[model samples]
Target: MAYKFEVYTDKAGEFRFRFRASNGEEMFGSQGYKQKASAMSAIESIKAHAPGATIEDQTK
Candidate 1:
């Protein structure tokens, strides 16, 4: 797959997730969650919402 979501445990022993591109560069990362299921739920939420997401440029 060109894009993927990776779930991992950080050094602090907290569960987290990262979104990577095809070249293995991290596009973004999520805040640490105490539960792995919470991390997975975050991923699912992104999948469900990101497709219809809009870009709001607040830098104006």
Candidate 2:
């Protein structure tokens, strides 16, 4: 199974996505973008590098 992004609050309490490992027991990249679109873009970028990697982006 691929990883998925989960919601987590930042130091400023902003909503963002975080990557969990395939085992679902490890944390990877946690990205906080200005807009959901940016976050999605980030996910796309990541996907380009890792097609099967778990990726998630904000869509608000």
Candidate 3:
């Protein structure tokens, strides 16, 4: 896959997720969630919504 989502436990023992690029660089890291299911849900949400997501360029 050119892109992937990784789920991991942070130092504080919270479940976190990171989206990585094909080069293995992290594009973004999600906030810590107390439950793994929440983290998974977040990933799923991204998958479901990101395709049609729009860009709001605040720098304009």
Candidate 4:
């Protein structure tokens, strides 16, 4: 796969998520969550909403 989501415990022992490319580069990372389920939910939400999201070029 070219991309994937990873969930892991941080140094602070909190659950977090990161989206990585096949080459192992991180594309994005999520805020720490108190529960694993919350992190999973955040991933699902991104998958569900990202398809219709628009790109805004604010750097112009």
Q: Candidate 1 clashing pairs?
A: none
Candidate 1 backbone clash number: 0
Question: Would you list the C-alpha lDDT of every candidate in the order shown?
Answer: 0.96, 0.69, 0.97, 0.96
**lDDT tens digits by residue: candidate 4, 1-60:** 689999999999889999999999999999999999999999999999999999999999
- Compute each candidate's TM-score over C-alphas: 0.94, 0.53, 0.94, 0.87
Off by over 4 Å in 1: none
Error of 3 at 6 (Å): 0.6
Q: What's the true lDDT of residue 12 in model 2?
A: 71
Clashes of each: 0, 0, 0, 0
Q: What is candidate 2's local distance difference test score?
A: 0.69
Candidate numbers, best lDDT first, in rank order: 3, 1, 4, 2
Better of 2 and 4 by lDDT: 4
* Candidate 1 lDDT (Cα, 0 to 1): 0.96
What is the TM-score (0 to 1) of candidate 2?
A: 0.53
Off by over 4 Å in 3: none
* Candidate 4: stretches off by over 4 Å: none
Model 1 Cα lDDT, one tens digit per residue, 1-60: 599999999999999999999999999999999999999999999999999999999999
